[model samples]
Target chain A: MIEEREIHKEYEIKENPLVDVAAYLFLEDIADKQGAAGMNNYLISLATSLAKSMPEEEYKTWEDFVESLEKGESIISTFESVRAKTNHCMVTHKCPFERGWKEYTKRIGDFARVHKEVADYYNSTVKPGVNDTQCIICQTFRAAAAERITVAKKRLKYAQLAAVAPDGSKKIAPDEWKPILLEKAGVTNTDLNMVLRNNACIWILY
Target chain B: MLDVALVSLIQDMSEKAGVEGTIQYWERVGESLAMRMGKEAYMGWPSFNVALREGRTAYSIEGDVTPLTDLAVTDVDGDVVGYIYALKTCVFEPTMQRVRYSVGDVPQADAAVAEEYNNSVKDTAICNFCVIHQKFREEVAKNITVADQPLECVQLADRGFKGETKIARDSLKRIGINPEYVRSLLRNYACVFAILMKGARLKGEEEVEE
Candidate 1:
């Protein structure tokens, strides 16, 4: 069995605190300008733009998509398959943005001045006058970060569709992919919200 | 380097208040430590002048006093961005090492605690765990101007033996250092200084003859 320390060592090697700090600062900047929902939409839009810009041939298969995503500069660490059963694939990878926000909170002892809604949500969930790691700000960043994976999966599904229908008569609209990806992953809004808030690393997909 | 009691207090404060709070608290500690070290510990150009007068190209101090060696870090354009200090013969190596080891020993249940411990250790280690502390670097950077441009965004970089030799060698070469003395210093001390400062953009660029 692979020892736990060995797994930690793998993470340690990949942990770039500087990158994390930069990401955290970026998130704080965005959150300050836009509300939580605006931040979410911005991230989704950014991911969609990134996905649209990628070479279509690179995401022809699920494995190919995963490989391409891993190679992308935005990804902090390598992904590991946690579950690979039939019709179900779950992978986990560390998010440096989350790590950076966590570190910021631990060191600076206060959340970056964000929109009132973002701060309000965090305040409502976590007790007042306490600054522990249960950060909604980081969670927002993590949820937005997860949009990249969703967009990639949608592109892969579109590729599969294109392969089946070579005539290109049928098409899935960009707006339709969010529900489609979620349905394929067998995830509900509650499940996704839970994953976003707590387990930001794992991505479940078909 | 902080004492055991201070480290523990900072660790506890880190747990309660977060790393940012701890850093703010650490600044106070640095101030207090600087006061305790007395007037001689404060580094100035006179110190550098004294070293030059003594026929030493690099700043060197003796005895149990904290040794602060100034280093000018340059950019790709060869412009002096900021300064760093090398703390030779670090007295708090044992304490810093103990704190580093204890990070591993922290239970998996207390992952946050372990992370906080690790960060605190890093913050101290960046200053070479010297008694002079991190604030001194900031204080010095604030007063420095390169090519008539004041330095801004002074930040502390990592403190490790990894690239110390190269940094020390490069900085020393810039000032036309004594090779034999530097060779002996590196051979004995192993470049235990923490680097401070980030690159600053000079207002105007002067064309160079290639």
Candidate 2:
């Protein structure tokens, strides 16, 4: 605590109210600008410690303003997150490597404890702000679900044109044309059913 | 020696195909082939590369910073010697106006917390995590203004950590940069300093974290 004070002192930043107001007012100015609106909330929170000096009552909810002030939880920067990968470390700690309950009753208790840990962590951690909106897991799953539902709705139009399969299950995709095109083009990574259903409305290959 | 052969080949092709358009067309192809062949092979060729030319906006310099947008740098023979590209970092900015990007702000990117709260909102122009898309880049330079000064060109990399690139190092080898010091691009992900884009009129309500 003393070291932190000295460090702030070295920069000539004492606990002055005028300085605190001016700083948050400055944040309010930047935050109000339309050009800067696209920046992710989590990215801005990296500098949230500066707002720790901000007094309560200046915001809609003092609890929320104080909650955002807690930093260091998100260590990964935007550049580091080049690829989509989930960070599931909270639950991992509860489940130790190469270790599980061997006894029957103990196993039941362990499973319940792990589930509680995850629920508690998410409750305590997910900030009540825009950061929650850009949650990677929520964004990815929403996009996938939206794509699936969209395709399912559109598939209704083609059900009358095609006959029901041998097992009486409606064919979601026509297998004849895509396979021939895939073979001729020598493309195999993507499934025609998946791509045509989810990717785009118009189909053209170049 | 190589220039004579290239000229003769172009002349021969120009005679067979309509000279008006095909000459310039084939010339571009020939220059690209010569550039891919490397500088050594085109010793007697005329150089036409503007790898470090000045006075052009980002729009004119490379067209678009978006991927697949090619900016060809060629020699006098019109052979492509290098390619100057707008790095993907420009993906975040709005392509509204005429702008350009420069390299060298390494320390800014690493600065987590800034000391001394100046209480001046004008200083937060640091686009550490800002995104300027294609729309922002096409903004007219005259539209941008800050503190009554014409903010014709706001460089994101200028305020924060600098972006570095190796396109000049590998392509323009005669620039005498140490190859080891330059970056080796992987999947075209080079550290670009910032993209200068066209400025647009602001309705004046924005936040760094939206």
Candidate 3:
């Protein structure tokens, strides 16, 4: 019964920091990667309200509690600094998201420091080629490249489209498609030609 | 991006609570947001940004992506440069408590009822304590910079700064915070904390190749 009560209490209308952190992280991720404004708004509102409910004992006032929330941004900024050392931001000009969960959170400096030991162990004991050593630079580069690929895929959505002719002639194929598709699909629609008229037509000398 | 201390604290707490799984859950949510937002927003890890360069239509930054927690493009000329979109969550309802001692018409002693009440009290105490942490986490996520830098009056004054802490400290003093604490804060928070989180992501990439 105590266990049940505890479980129920946890599930009940009470603030669970774990849940809060999870929710905050969730919405922030949404706000950042997905631009889910609504979800972000919901998470932010919950977080703000929870912050407001702090017992005055833990903080001098609601304002002080709210201020700590401000510190979260600072924490984020610090992470950026850490990411910077790895060139995760500048080279990518963005947050590194092309990586798996592990790649994003694994501190590269730490990885490099520890990886060599593991690599050495494998190299000294394992068979050649079987004990392939992992290099930090390669890992970091791989992560960056992966992130680049992801970015490229996202950017490709806005890529300009062009038409190529099989016979190298200026011709709107029976390939003329729907206007909406045409408008949304290719290079500027103004670039398209309605007809292939020639000046060879008989003209009155004016 | 997140401050090392805060991340350490959160990481510690998460470990204590056996909630590392939560990180993956949030990451999934972040990924989902990235997919959905598409070109409307930049879906950098740990944060998001709204700026889009001309002729570029993607959520991924072509160059180094600023963490959502940084204010790089948001603050210019010692003033917040751009609009900040905010999101948050609401508090859930509290648990209920039952009072009584009537079972099979056998009157229970007040001592037994007092024990139950005491346990309830203890449970509520624990619940309150847990709530504080939850609240803290939620608030922390709100108003985070595109990078993970904390928003302070001093930092606010140096929004678009491109110099060392010395320049920032002087600027903060000009804005009214004591020069001493400003320097201290800059050293502790800016140098150590923000350095790791807000530091440029792409600057040293070329050097690493060597």
Candidate 4:
């Protein structure tokens, strides 16, 4: 028989809370007020603004810009940039938000319970569609993550032009850069859409 | 962590088959390893129980719960069920070292090496561990007898979320769970919940003499 003492002994350990409950509650409150879709939009916009906050002068080229993004300590770890055939460069990394959630789950206990609670709250309050099995919190987090990539791509495009022509005399239209970037990065529109929509690890950057 | 030869092989595969093909090849490697290791080494019930016991004790005392080894399992009641041990540090330490090394600023080959290594490799490694554990569960169905009742291990996390692409899809399908989420728990971790439940007989298994 499994002794109660053994079970109790095993159940005793706990870790220091990595994230403050108050912070989580605060986010939860905002999520509650905004509802699912609104909160998702809000998160994406926040990520966009955060990406834009990076100073452009620090980077000489698109590569420099991409390198700078990974300089600081973050919840996300393990970043790799793989250059495929042609001009396609794939920047892949583990999702930081997902890592944070795992740590948070370790501290709190039971991922399913937490997921269910959040899902229940959203389903009851927001009235999800019949086919919508998607978790609101996950959707919101993923949107924000995908937005970061999108904004970074835009910034990289500008940096690419600046690298080619430092002087203001040579003018390259922003619209033209989009196609040039697509060709240079060796990524098609479909690839970009898939990466964004799926929150894929690989980011197409030239 | 993979050996230098394996890493070179992966790189070579990437060159020949592209990123998607390389990832697929890696998945096959993991599956083969799992098969070779056998069921007990990869998915023994006792091993999982011990891991859970150790994890709970480690976490309760505010001890350092090493990733890929000490994983904390939780149940539907928001209670910590127990930890399921997966890989030792020795198993993936070299890989972590490679990640650290790759992160340094150095232009290598056509790609300018980024500051950090891609975590997909680590995630895939952990997923491979899960694949091994799942293989046993699928084949045997019931491999252990606890308190005179036969018990089967049920993984809380779906086994379909094995590779990076499938993991990405599962992240959306299962809400927030992804490869990173699994790897963060431990290097070689299994997120099993059913075996930790109370009263095995109540779950409808025959009570036999131990």
Candidate 5:
């Protein structure tokens, strides 16, 4: 009754750090490549949504990640400095995303070093031309990202095109729509803000 | 006439970007935009100074034909120098996607697709030469050179480029080459014999060689 794609996919992901890393890369690739990276909060939500879909039994948590380091099982465990501080972040305060997913989590001291390997591990899902295990998953993620980007673009366009404020309290001139459109598009970071600013540029010659 | 401001921009960007590569890229981008807007649309730019119109027109004409393979011009002070390849091959585009393949380049419509295109009423070709046609840019890069100019951004637009196509078209009508041979060549190779041999040659015009 179920399709082949549905069989291997876990509906509710466990609090495994390994799985979380994979989901992070997947979320980033979809959003960044498809022009949805501007929606920072939306991207975090999408990652959470995707992370919430896998089975916990198959993955490891932040505590487990630290344990793996001590045991020298994972590539990430080799760094003693980063592993030294993991317990405190795990015991005292959970990172924002991890707050809901788990009761306890460890903070990565050398996040940059850890992320490089995490990215590599995530990319290991494919062997280029030979085998692509994540092809279907990537397609699905891109489709989702495209939908989000389309909605965001349209919402911004509507804000620009609207003659009056949403509350009907004030009328907006066509020339004044640029700033409002940027705000509506959620241009928080430098990159997305640049994209928004570029849309308003028009060269006048003479 | 020259475009002083544009040259300044390109030169400035190139220096800041730390490479001549970037400036060349920007010029190519400008050329592509001009080609897309076309001569009519470019002249319609209301803010452009009346004095600069002639220079703009010349740039537009060059964008239309030169480097049919890519940005065919070099950005000068305020002017652009372009070269239209003076090939004698008939360049036919029965389909927009398959236009890169020159089947009738041999003074006759020899490619099967060419024959089918010439005879059929359908806009799309029965045989899609897209795969082979796609490689034309890279091959052109590897092969063709006019003076020392290199095409930076090769592309085919919706509006067909009529280069040396007329001569080749006339040649096809004059000689009676088989459509099957043309099609086989197109299917097997990206270009016809004549086009591959001395393709996209831009020199002073002369009588048709073949």
Candidate 6:
């Protein structure tokens, strides 16, 4: 616990109420655009945390905290759309393996932004002032499920290759085929087992 | 190379030959050859699994059908080396995309006929596998010193671990890797990781068990 405190002290927290409000507003915008209506509860919790952190002179009520957020300056940075970001990375990278990593990060970042945006909108707009706290749980679940499905799809392709030798045993070297699967799938042995254990027969046919 | 046009012709002919005709064709063609050649002798083998290591449409067949044309053996430069006989007793099934041919036959038979049949069977496997069958054939012809002996199932089964391992290995190799280190890593740490990860997930279940 002492270590944790020291670690925390090493990185001082930003205490600006407007900064907190700006973060929430950004999340609200993300939620609105990404069809993520499940982050409202988390957004509320975040708002509450910010409110608590606020000096007593800044605001006493939660409503006052939200109002302060609405008044904050709107700064739009150079954020690229998910599709554009992915395409740019895929086209520009010399190595396909590296490109795939960039593309995945960009996609995850975009989805995270979308989740925040949806949460903010729900908290500030729909059911405004309602204190229900289940929205955050649902958003987390949606994100988790989406990630699993994407991973499952990629792993399934590797399994398909294993079933059929690429060069046709008479044709290609069987030894060569195995390495190709790893390179293309971006999977290590550890990842492959996780995929196989999680997926198995279901991944192939289904 | 078997002409795609010829395959279309045979398929059209066989379909017109009707269901009974198809069966009779197999029985007379596929079965008779299987009987006459006594599968072991290679005259009448019905089917055999051709081996492939990597790529799409890996496994294929030999003597799966009769050739529609004669074959003239040639080198990579198209120079004639030796001629292989072609036979018509083998039937081609385009729908199945298989060449029903004999694995072995009487040596005295026309080399041109045997060559055609070999070509047809090959074309069928290629079509079925939806791969460039020639490339596979060339690779096999080069790597496989003996086409006369088919790959035994026992041998294939011994290599079964390869199904999963190869996929992992191939993916790594594409980046110019010798994944022996990865295998060593897997051997050293994979099970430990699996248990640790699973223990975390099943922590609640285990608590209930406790």
Question: Per-model i-RMS in Å?
Answer: 17.0, 28.6, 16.3, 19.3, 26.3, 35.4
Please write out the lDDT profile of model 4 over residues B47-92, one tens digit for every residue.
5455444654212111232323333334334444333323222222
Which segments of model 1 are wrong by more than 4 Å?
A1-12, A30-96, A113-154, A157-183, A186-206, B1-210
lDDT of 2 by residue, B60-84 (tens): 2222243222433333344433333
List DockQ, one per candidate, in order: 0.01, 0.01, 0.05, 0.02, 0.02, 0.00
* Residue A141 CA displacement from its true place in model 2, Å: 24
lDDT of 1 by residue, A1-206 (tens): 23643544344334433223323343444455666655544443433332332223323466655544444322212222233221432323233234444544443345544533553444354322112222222233223334444433463221110000111112111335546645666656455445434332333334
> Cα deviation of B63 in candidate 6 (Å)?
53
Misplaced by over 4 Å in model 5 are A1-34, A37-206, B1-205, B208-210
Q: How would you encode candidate 1's per-residue C-alpha lDDT over B1-210 as one tens digit per residue?
A: 012212333334455666555455445444432232222221444444344345332122111222333545455466545443333443334333333422222112223432443466432233322323445343433444334443332222223333333223433443334445555455555333322223433222221211
Candidate topping lDDT: 1
What's the distance in Å from true for residue A108, model 1? Answer: 1.3
Which docking category, incorrect, acceptable, medium or high, applies to candidate 3? incorrect
Give one digit per residue, the lDDT tens place, for model 4 in A1-69. 236323322222121122222123323443566665554443334333332322223234545544444
Residues A1-206 of candidate 5: C-alpha lDDT, one tens digit per residue: 13421321121112223223223333333344443322233333333233222212211344554454344332221111122222321110111223211211221121222222322333343211101112222222222322322221231011111111111122122344445543443432243333223121111000
Flag regions of model 4 displaced more than 4 Å. A1-17, A20-26, A52-54, A62-88, A105-184, A187-200, B1-210
Backbone clashes, each candidate: 6, 51, 74, 16, 20, 57
Q: Name the runs in model 2 displaced over 4 angstroms.
A: A1-120, A124-206, B1-82, B87-210
CAPRI category for model 1 = incorrect
Best by TM-score: 1
What's every prediction's RMSD, in angstroms? 19.1, 28.7, 26.8, 21.6, 24.0, 30.5
Interface RMSD of 3: 16.3
lDDT at position B82, candidate 5 = 35
Native contacts matched by each model: 0.00, 0.00, 0.10, 0.01, 0.00, 0.00
- Measured with C-alpha atoms, the lDDT of residue B112 in candidate 3 is 32
Real contacts retained, model 2: 0.00
